[model samples]
Target: MRVFATLLRRDLAMLLPGGRRGQSLLPFLFFLAIAMLYPFAVGPDADLLRRTGGGVIWVAALLASILPLDRLVAPDIEQGVFDQLAIRGIADEAAIAIRVLAHWLSFAPLLMVAALPASVLLNLDGSTLSIVVLGLLAGTPGLAAIGVTIAALTAGLRGGTALAGLLLVPLATPILIFGAGSLARPDDGGILLAAAISLVALAIAPFAGGAAIRAARDS
Candidate 1:
């Protein structure tokens, strides 16, 4: 338990602002850029923007989530961090689980906050903005899970970063679909489904990532 906490703190420091890479705000900035660009790209059709803004935010969040995929596990693998963890009796699955949690913390909350101003930029109504926030809360964990799993899988291959982005779009599309779909339905079942998917993704990521890391280590 103590080791997990220690690993989690290390990952947070590495991923958060002023850490190693120093790009902690990239996801937030990229998310807003997409939201801001949506208006100009589609012209000033207020109703169209309002009707679709939530979906646009969903897309932007999904894209932004993948931005750090390359950084998630690749560097650690290259640096033999996992090898060291193994010597300390820290299983890869536990390590990856911690990474998944840390990754979500690093970016999901920022995107949620960014959604506020993005809602204004897209002219989202108060109710719609609420739904958007709800959808993001439920969906980003799954996106983070998928991101970490893909990062582990593609960590060392040539052009893996681009490959990770490509892989993420498809894997995360279901979350996007259901998350954005929630805005259209008052039942809120879409958000529920999105949340369910997130749980499943979260459950699977650690084992999958650990296995991938082991495979990478062996080969």
Candidate 2:
């Protein structure tokens, strides 16, 4: 627990130079603005807005998540923190898990908060909003996990973000399917299935990411 807290603090410090200036908040704000603008760009009809809301919000969330992936592992690798941690007897698996958690802490909440205003703009109903929030709560961890692994794998590469996307988007298909599906059938078993898939992804991501990071470090 203490190790996690310490690492979390270290990550936060790295991410935010000054606590007063929230760094990742800008991306979230941009996500909100862009999501809100979609309806206006499409049309003002409430029915049209409602029909498109789920996809628009989900796409926006996915895009917003992409913005943070480069920051996940590059800085640590560049500054030798990753190597230091590797030398400190922390297992690569555990270290990657901690890093993913830290990434989630910084990025997922920003997406959730940003989603709220976009939800209103999209005309999400009570049930749909709850499902969206729940899906995000469940799914973003998976995104962060895969994202951390991809980030680690491409840590030193130029244009890593684009590479990461290519590697990650296919992996993220399940997440997008279930997450968006949850919105379509909030009352059905689909939401539960989405949540289940998320948990499974969460379980799978750490080990996958850890192995990738370990391999990257070795090579």
Candidate 3:
């Protein structure tokens, strides 16, 4: 537990350095801005806003989550941290878990925070807001897991951003479907199904990503 906490703190310190330019703050704010613009561009009808809020929020969350993938492994790889971890006594599985957890920590909260203003812009009610938050909580882990895999695969590649999106979007369709479906009918079984799928994805993706990272390291 202490090791995990130390690793998380260390990674956060490295990723979020204090400076005039906050590294991730801009991108996160940009995501929020974009999400807020959707309802205005569609028109000012409250019903339309309510109906579309789920899809808009889900789509924005997915995109926002994707934005951080390129940076996930790049800095560590560039700084030789990846190489050091590879040769260190720590188990590869543990290291991969740490990396994935750290990535989740950095990216998921930003997406959730961004979602708040978006919900308001879309005129989401309490139910929709709750659904959106729950879906994000359930789905973002899957996003991070898949992002971790892509980050590892493209850790050394030049056009990683495009490649990561190409690889990720297809895999992320199920999550999008479930997440949006949950919001569509928060009272129905759809939301539960979505939550179930998200939970499954959350459980499965990390193991798959960890294996992929280990294989990538070996190759």
Give the whole-model CA lDDT for all candidates, comma-separated.
0.95, 0.75, 0.72
**TM-scores for the candidates:** 0.99, 0.89, 0.85
**Which candidate achieves the best lDDT against the true structure?**
1
Error of 1 at 194 (Å): 0.3
| Candidate 1 structure quality by residue, lDDT tens digits, 163-219 | 999999999999999999999997899999999999999999999999999999899
lDDT of 2 by residue, 22-64 (tens): 4677567768988879988988888888877877877777777
| RMSD to true structure for each model, in Å | 0.7, 2.3, 2.7
Off by over 4 Å in 3: 16-22, 186-188, 204-207, 210-219
In candidate 2, which residue ranges exceed 4 Å CA deviation? 16-22, 186-188
Poorest 10 consecutive residues by lDDT, candidate 2: 14-23
* Top candidate by TM-score: 1
TM-score sort, best first: 1, 2, 3
Q: Could you tell me the TM-score of candidate 1?
A: 0.99
